[model samples]
Target: MTNTAATEIDDTSSAFTPNLTIDVGGAPMLYRRTGRSSHTVPPLVLLQHFRGNLDYWDPLLLDTLAADRDVITVDLHGVGGSGGQTPDNVSDMTRNAIAFITALGLTEIDLLGFSLGGHIAQEIALVRPRLLRRLVLAGTAPQGAPDLHRWSEDVYRWATGDVTAPEDFISLFFSGSDDGRQRAWEYLARTHTRQQDRDPESSLACRDAQFQALMTWGIPESAKLQRLSAITQPTLVANGDNDTMMYTKNSQLLAENIGGAQLRIYPDAGHGFLDQYPVQFGQHVRQFLGC
Candidate 1:
């Protein structure tokens, strides 16, 4: 008698889906899950840039990737709706991420990290080894890259400012070209489509802690590049040709040291190139992820 009761599937493929929460280590961790589930492809977990909350992602990019497979984005401890003190070091951040993943009951998955999140992804891969099936690092650098311990003067003006305006975001993420600015505007529009239940802005404590962690991670130790050999998962390293925030060369360095890692550089773009070329980059990611 109950065989024909509501056969339609629940479609959570939209980035505007309401935020969900789960307890991780006695604290609530906020996250969003999108797209359809696949038996062969693991859910793609995303980590955002410094000072970015779960709502910072471009919805167009998320939906594009979600069309084929599941996508998950988390607020990480103390960063948004998630509860806990923000960690001051990448090691502690990685531990928090691991705890979140474990609480999700996931054994293997894919990871995509942007900027600060990319650093955490690399740490997770090295520390856990077998946890990730694939890795994607965008607009980020490896630890101990020479002269990368601090932000450049021009970059410091916008990235560390008390308030980030559209102009600041344009300067930090897109290229100076007119076309690049147009793309940035479009990407910004897409990110705002979700009108309700948005994650709160990251706190000043989170910003300061993250910056300190970056400084510590970039202490100019060359041997850290050698550590890339430990991560055996298939990796995709991508960035804009002129990423002022993390530098384009860092992406090259990541690809070079990671052994057979693929690299993609978007022309006339900057740190947020992935968002600037959302559809294209999303397709590239889907292809790389084999979704």
Candidate 2:
């Protein structure tokens, strides 16, 4: 188990010292920033996958984004540094996220969300369309909403002491990419330190709350395909070719649904598309931002 604290590059450094908490709406949330770009250029915010900690974000990839814009990567409510307190679930997560940005005093910025984060990003767009300059949805889906029922149950069991069958838990999140399943498996192996006190149990509590709150997540059930017209921001929808969970068609569906939204499908990618192809993914994001 790698602590990764000694060499941690993304969270804190003398250079990117953030004020930790912000008064967004009513919730005081934790967020980190890096790079020194001025207000002339908008900042960038990142939303990671299901139960993703800020430390879990691949450092090299974050540094890449940091070079171009001030980047904000947050641990969503009930996960990571921000997971203290009651979130109510992903629905509340959406509300808290908007507050996180608003509290930071950022009105317009580029937003990127991966996997579960993508779900939150979409909900935010619905609630506060004007707050975003652009929106990027990566390795996520508009459907397959509660298909996580069993997965959530598994998380509950795993958290309570059942060893997470790493393969079953992880295979669904990968898409065969530049490195195929081997690389995906290897990266997961390297990063998978059982955090014990801070491991899956706490996360499952949040997921259970989210599962219940999903009943009111406000994501369209018939889930209107044309709802993207309401989003007044340039959008990029992308995913890996072999994402087992959301699949490529989901990305296509989002792009097709959202007005003027562009779709980019990677040749040998999985749900961890950005991690598998960081350079290419970063380049694509830069292009989308018109940088």
In order of appearance, the predictions have TM-scores of 0.94, 0.77
Candidate 1 Cα errors over 4 Å, as ranges? 1-13
C-alpha-based local distance difference test score of model 2: 0.65
lDDT tens string, model 1, 16-121?
Answer: 6778999987889999998889998999999999999987887778888889788899988889888888899999999999999999999999999999999999
Lowest lDDT block of 10, candidate 2? 193-202
Q: Quick one: best TM-score, which candidate?
A: 1
What are the lDDT scores of the predictions, listed in order?
0.87, 0.65
lDDT of 2 by residue, 1-291 (tens): 223332433234322334365555544556667766755568888987655566556545566677657888876556655545536656678877876787778878889988778878887888888788889999776643323333344334532332345564445555533346565554454344322222233356655555454434424354444555687688999898876555567788778778898999887776777766665788788877876
- TM-score quality measure for candidate 1: 0.94
Q: Which stretches of candidate 2 lie over 4 Å from their true place?
A: 1-19, 23-28, 83-90, 143-170, 176-178, 185-202, 213-220
Report lDDT (Cα) of residue 206, candidate 2. Answer: 57
